[model samples]
Target: MPAGPLRGTIRVPGDKSISHRAVMLGALAIGETRVTGLLEGEDVMATAAAMRQMGAGAAKHADGWRIHGVGVGGLLQPAMALEMGNSGTSTRLLMGLLASHAITAAFTGDASLSRRPMGRVIEPLSRIGASFTPSPGGTLPLMMTGAPVPVPIEYRLPVASAQVKSAVLLAGLNTAGITTVIEPVATRDHSERMLRGFGAELEVEELDGERIIRVRGEADLTPQTIEVPGDPSSAAFFIVAATLIEGSDLTIENVGLNPTRAGLIDVLRQMGASIEELNAREVGGEPVADLRVRHAALSCIAVDPALAPSMIDEFPVLFVAAALAQGRTVTRGLDELRVKESDRLAVMAAALTAAGARVEETADGLIIDGTGGEPLRGTANARVKTHLDHRIAMSLAIAGLASQAGVEIDDTRPIDTSFPGFIPLIEGLRHSS
Candidate 1:
């Protein structure tokens, strides 16, 4: 993984979360919705395909992806099961889309995704009058029948899950009344923000330390032209890589800096990473910025548990950053990581350990002893297992670049689930250097 300092300006793919919601919402709108800068990742593509299968017109043009939606409550029952490759986000959010429509659909996915718990979405969606027949473990390969006469109810999230919250709110869109989601802990607000952008009557208010998000039912969604900002989660890999490798000064352009999704930047800055926001501005109703990250001496700090939701997807890479910091890094309140495409906490712990990082796996989080800014010894002759997780693959790839011996990953194909051109992007930086 030895290399000279990384130097370049790059724009990662569009935000996956926002892209997924855009496709879903566009498919449910009344007219043609155009989306530029849409993420073409496998996960987001799955949502598009599912929407197409349910009588929506989804096509990619030279400019961007375009969607001709079936109006609200106009979804057709799919003739075949919806195949969600490795995207839990797609599966969960699409489940919500199906909940209030008068459509019956079956959801299937890859082995990693099939193992993930869908019960979180299932319980609340069922309360909104959707009928679900989940597998034995409450995982995928599930069958769902959307409510013929949906009911609107207020649901309080038992855990901090944006997916679950999104599912309930989406179901409310086709029901007769308001669907309320009470979040004791906030997750990403992309769903709420995009819902409002599409003309859904949604409002958010905070009361007594909890967030109350309500969406009016039977929404008349208007078509929109959306420009998805660059994915901060995707850009996180380069940010960490640049910070860990000496002499690196890299700038990532048009990155989404949504407060709920920008916690990684805050934590990294607190750990003494030199990340500067240049040309901070707004794009598509979300905060956007170009980030200039330079190599810096890093000191590990205890990660606050409360910040997990905002940067949940970036923790694998953050673990890699922590593994190379000056001291031990402790993280907790990440049990949610256990239910992602893979067991991220365990997989990252084992992968880094194989590459010579001192790591202790905990029930909820990990304890990583950094190399004190030195290159990892790498796996020597062994390969790190990705477990079909995109973040695990990319995070270890970054680790490899800072390793004495290049890290070998068992599979990097999973990267296409989110960051499609990751290898090419890294190679471009290497060649440019």
Candidate 2:
């Protein structure tokens, strides 16, 4: 499908995770928080719109995005339902932020997001004194009434989820005392670090092989200028494309390399891919570097389950790399994938199989047999069902690039949710290279 090698220097969108947190935290600060390099994706725009609806001042300027805050516990009741579009992060985090305030709001999303569970956040927020009336099966299209006098308590995560951890921490922000979260497995620490940056009293300690995070509630926040970095998650498609396509030598610039989120790079390196880190630096409290990737012969290996937290969102694309590798790639301990935007495990397995690769779906993970680096002759007239999941659409597009015939997706509209202009970027690289 690809005309030739994809060789170029490019930068993906700003970190989606960081961009979401910045707007939320900035809206709770005392003054204007200016953010440069904010992602202008539909998902993030939904968060910003929700913030604006709740009395935060959000507007785009010639320089960047400027958000005027109303301080902690200052959110106003929205006049309409908060449309979340497709962002689980925005919904869960906002539920926590609203849990300790005295306002009531309704949360709704598109069909894909409506199927994902919100009970993970609801259980903790309910304990913090908020009340929720979720749809059948604890999904969205729900009403949440904030606790006028919220209670602070210690919560232990029943599962490994950064969203769950962040929800509890955010609810603790407007509470009256110290609230704590005990994480059996560490997820991303963006919330913890960003909380401290915005002047919340927070502490982290490791005891008995678990992480304990505590935050003082009802704290005042200070606004600051934030320089967001390129997203590594958005960078994955091109990274894998460059690695799988012959003669590809691509340099992706300013990708966030947070240690907690770099497991994909590690796994690819273990599978014998050529990725070199250049210009290592730190921006906005996160490590970042340029990645120079070249096409190389890949081999299969069993992925470490513990690394799942770091690379959870990446497994879909990783499945593509594995399908064309030299042996069977065994991935396990991915039970969490079942609860994402779609059942990523099942969707990716089916998509790869339809594209002429050998992929077996397992209960918790996927078992994929590689083509030993041979380009797949894609199945004729069989299109990939993306299920409105953006990663699936993009990952399969990359598969088409490395195949004799192009992969066809049911829809590419979902690609704009996170990585807008994705097709243009790929086309630019294809023609210029």
281: Cα error in model 2, Å: 0.7
Which stretches in model 1 have alpha-carbon errors above 4 Å?
Answer: none
For candidate 2, give the lDDT. Answer: 0.93
Minimum summed lDDT over a 10-residue window in model 2 is located at 375-384
> What lDDT score is found at residue 415 in candidate 2?
90
lDDT of 2 at 367: 97
lDDT of 1 at 305: 98
Using all chains and alpha carbons, the TM-scores for the candidates as numbered come to 0.99, 0.99
Tens-digit lDDT track of model 2 for 1-433: 5548989899999999999999999999999999999999999999999999999998999999999999998889999999999998899999999999999999999999999999999999999999999999999999999998999989999999999999999999999999999999989888998899899999999999999999999899999789888988999988899999989999999999987788899999999999999999988788989999999999999999999999999999999999999999999999999988889999999888888899999899999999998887775687779999998899888888878887889999999999999999999999998
Q: In model 1, what is the error at residue 213, expressed in angstroms?
A: 0.4
Per-residue lDDT of model 1, residues 136-163, tens digit only? 9998899999988888999999999999
**lDDT (0 to 1) per candidate:** 0.93, 0.93
Pairs that clash in candidate 2: none
